[model samples]
Target: MKHPYSPGRVLCALHFTLTVFLLVRGRPKFLWFRPLSPEKLMDAIAQLGVCFLKLAQVLATRADFFPLEYLDKLKTIHDQVSPMNAEEYEKVFARAFPDPSCFSFFDSAPLASASIGQVHEARLQSGERVAVKLRRQGVDRLVEKDIRLLRGILWLAQPLFSRLTRNSLEAVISEFSDMIRRETDMLSECENLEQFRKRFVKSDVTLPEAYRELTSSDALVMSFIDGVRIDDKEAIGAMGIDGEKLISKLVVFYMEQMLIAGFFHADPHPGNLLVQKGGRLALLDFGMVKRLSNATRIAMIEVVKAANERDFELYILACKRLGVVAADAPDDKMTEFAERIFDIFGDARLSASSMRDIAFTTLASMRDLPFKIPQEVVYVMRVSSLIEGLGTTFVDNFNGVKDVLPVLKSNLTRALGAEAGLFPTIGQELAGLPLTMRRAKTVFNDLAEQNLHVKLSRETLDLLEGRIRNMMRPICQGGLFILAAFLVVGMELPWKNEIAVLLFAVGALRIVIGLK
Candidate 1:
């Protein structure tokens, strides 16, 4: 069946693609092309509306994917998105609460607005204060259309990317599509809130109570959360909360989410996190959440253990198991990558900015190698990066690697499903000893037979060859001029001078044309 394409979607997709294309062409290597300014790119994304704004929020967390200037602009996108107008707000409220008597009083103004919904402070008939989350009118349909448009664009460009790159791109789009679609459903968010409440019931971390009786598909009513925004350092200090303790507690809570529970709140921006009196943390907005499979979680544990132990081979193996590094990635190159990674984490004294610089540099180099970050790790990285950003706001010289590695190392036993008993852990390791030995033996045998294969896919080889050719062209041109000069000076033939001039002319022409 043929589907009708709207003009608006067509224009949006074209603008999105052109902006990205310009950004790529504006890289340092493309000297002839005019550079795309970060401000222009951010403006373009903002014009694309809420769906793209959400994407920009995720992209902002990726220091490796963009320059620092671009990251700075992207970080501001989510907070700056415009809220719904009065007419739209009234329409949604009416549809969500047809009875009109559910709330005794609802403020006309929203307390906060986001890409998917807006939150308003209201009071129930019993005089209890609540925050009502109202979904934007037709937002679900808008999300669906936007995702379809994005998916179509990606499908058209699939043949241009390598298999590994294609897989990673597809995984990202798929993850975002599923996440945003689910986010439009207020019921699912309510359930997520309830699940978190149950999980963290014993912890000092606070969660607002969900009013399931009052929630509907378009609106969710919950107990209002009151506190200072986590980033408001002055307010926190005035409230007599220890900044250091709050930072430590935040790290510990995230450690429980990522390393132990395997399920976590994906969005940890400052606005979503609050610090109540006595250093109690209140987490808000559960619309965006992520879960790690058992395999992925265990592989992450292995990655942490390998990094802490400085085991290069183990690190690469863990990366492979986590679906980040290709299984057939060359061993020597993987070792180099592992070394670069270890250097980033080795120094506890490195500040967040310095560590970020090292990490970004390493990742920029990795782009040329056979590496792909999986969908599962995308949000994990985002959460870590966002939390790291938060930590930097209050704590001096905060580094995520320094903070997380210790917590991960200490919780390895519990994360591995072993109780706080040495015997069970020993038994578990002994049970896997034979398999581990067999794998080691196989690797050694391959090395002995000189069968350590290096498989660079055709696309990667082509790209590398292209870069090499470009590099050698300039040298080859200079060599030609030298040869021509040598012939003119040394040879006595009548045509020698003519030949040298022709050679020089040809080389000069080639150089001139190459500049374009």
Candidate 2:
């Protein structure tokens, strides 16, 4: 029998040659190949078009997924990107804005470029310094074409790539595409910038003020910040101040954003952060920001609190919350990891050097077991690691554990201490936590009862509605996935589109009904 869609003769020949060459170059036992050097890989990616560029982007934020060495390497290209053609920029600008004469402050050469697009430093009619970010010309078409090509390539390469083996390649590509698509749309970036602006409206944390009139789906104009990148040591010392103090404030500001405000600057590496007078940490690039769901928030706070207090049980659950360990992780593995955590903190109590080693060792071990680090922790850990790296480079004798110990101790005590109101509050939050078992119970209980039904109190309908909203989050998440799959399989077969769309409808119904 003949199978269609087989590799062509030339491709087969090339693949065989590459495989043989890799086998000679790499470990025979693992069958691991020596991948292309980073520079060659980056060059290959650029040649592959914007989709591969987007893939590189998703890889950039996934610091937790990679080992320390790989993470260190990724940092080098965190913002370094080859600029797009200048003539293409003119077309994008012209399409986005009818008249180039209107934005006379435009510069042809880009100040910086990235997977999403490039930024050009420009001035406004009001004589204010601003950065104009322009979307690449024909980006939407490119995205559509590249995504189609990417799906084909992923489908083709699934057998060879180890990372894509255990996980769903379709899911990974979907996440990557969704992220880049959102990035491509300047409207979304504006929304993100506005969302971030609202988070720090009156704080020391400064966000760019977006100029709506000068913005469109393809271009964005916003206030330009002038300050040294937080990573640059000489610049900070040149300003005549304590680098450690500035770094400390940065740690606190970002922590407050994630813990208190729930809107975090997801890409808070030193490059994305700038330092100015009075220890102001200017936050740039809101493209990768993440908002913690209330349940996730409470869960994260509990997890960190547990680590600070050495509560093994809470620690296990926290690992579960972060998706580092399965909810059903073997008790021995759980105990081992828990003990490891205690030892790490115990050493951390003695010195900062110990704390860093402990965290790295623990993370490395987790990699051997290899579980998915939840998206929130993935982003948080990257930001946290960047902070740690910046501290090492810019601050003197920096100890994150020591600096954060007081606040952490306070929070942990507040969470676990037997004080009157504190215990009750902790209990309430604990009870309210989103356990998978609870969701299963709700679903099956309704199914066992042989009909979907709801009981509502007339007097507290508003409160009842809000309570349901809290319960329906999982359903909403399911809806997004269903819609994505529907978009994929629609053209494949008859009724498939309808079926996929129906799945989406059911998901939405679940959410709306749950909220009710």
Q: Pick the candidate with the highest lDDT.
A: 1
Candidates' C-alpha lDDT: 0.77, 0.63
- Summarize candidate 1's per-residue lDDT along 106-146 as a digit string, tens digits: 99788888778999999999999999999988889888887
Name the 10 consecutive residues with the lowest summed lDDT in model 1: 24-33
Per-prediction tally of clashes: 0, 0
Please provide, for model 2 over 83-124, each residue's C-alpha lDDT reduced to its tens digit, 9 standing for 90 to 100.
777677667877877866655477778877776678888776
Root-mean-square deviation of candidate 2: 13.6
Runs in model 1 lying further than 4 Å from the true structure: 1-9, 18-35, 348-352, 422-516
Q: Which residue segments of model 2 deviate by more than 4 Å? A: 1-34, 37-54, 57-69, 149-165, 168-172, 341-370, 375-377, 395-516
Error of 1 at 339 (Å): 2.4
